[model samples]
Target: MTEPNSKDPAPSPLGRRERLLLAAIAAALGLLLFQLRGGLQPQAPLEQMARRSLELPVALANGRPTILEFYADWCAVCRSMAPAVEAIETKHRGALDVVLLNVDNPRWAAEIERYDVNGIPQLEFFDREGQSVGRSLGGRSLAELDAIATALIAGKPLPRLAGVGSLSQLDVASTPVAGPRSHG
Candidate 1:
């Protein structure tokens, strides 16, 4: 047989252009898949639970009104009330400070006592002057919490929170001990 003509080619698995196109397709598909996978993932909970909260010292010295919330991971009431409280925190933003104290942590034992927090989901309201304006307990609705905060901010009597365990001003003379150390 004669030598192969220039136009005649030996069998090859892939031509250079074919391989390059294949690689480009693979790269594009990989990127598309990556983007799709990322988009499918769920977003982290936001404004449904307190994310960043004030520490005890900052809250004590904030000069702004505060809501000291005692909660624990296992407390059902605390869990149920988280969303409502979170909404309140978001709505009030800079006008108010919400401090979260995990009762499960020993660091807040002093605060647990100071607020007379025998049960969870307790709220202790402190005014700009660091005075204990009032304390409320149990799973309060968003409306109730909002009303309470508004009243506290306005220095008005708290709107009646029916079924709330306690909602009354603290005795100025009977000051709570130095606030608990924060885990924030």
Candidate 2:
């Protein structure tokens, strides 16, 4: 048998063409997985939204107030409000309805319109009958949110902070109002 020549360069561990193709395939798979992850994750279904009108209404109508949080993944305000909302949900567990609505879903456009939501982090309070009783917009502290919930439960108007606007003012047209409305 002829000995291999040491002067000849050894073959690459992987051919250049093969390496490029493998990299391309890997990149494609990575993108596919990134796109599919959201769908694969456990999320509230679109169909369940209709039930919000029915089930949530009934729950609210039965003397159990419901807290509806309209949020979007891209919204900083929504992300900031998440923990406070979670805390409120935990505090009032069996007594109130705490639901999160992803406003990014086109299916929720109608509900968004119905609620006249113009921004992220919209919190709506509904009576057991599903009638909207109160609303608060923007990020709030747990104490601030709890106070709103408390006022709703007691049928009292939300205490107005010196600079903060009322929930009604959070609507699309009213958002231009200047200054912070107090929730205390």
Highest-scoring model, TM-score:
1
Cα displacement (angstroms), candidate 2, residue 24, comes to 16
Note each model's CA RMSD in angstroms.
11.0, 11.2
Alpha-carbon lDDT, every model: 0.71, 0.64
lDDT of 2 by residue, 75-146 (tens): 666665666676776787677767776665554556778887876677788765667776777777778888
Which parts of model 1 are misplaced by more than 4 Å? 1-51, 165-184
| lDDT of model 1, residue 180 | 54
Q: Give one digit per residue, the lDDT tens place, for model 1 in 65-121.
A: 888887766566676677778888889888888888766555666677677766667
Q: Judged by lDDT against the true structure, how good is candidate 2?
A: 0.64
Error of 1 at 12 (Å): 32
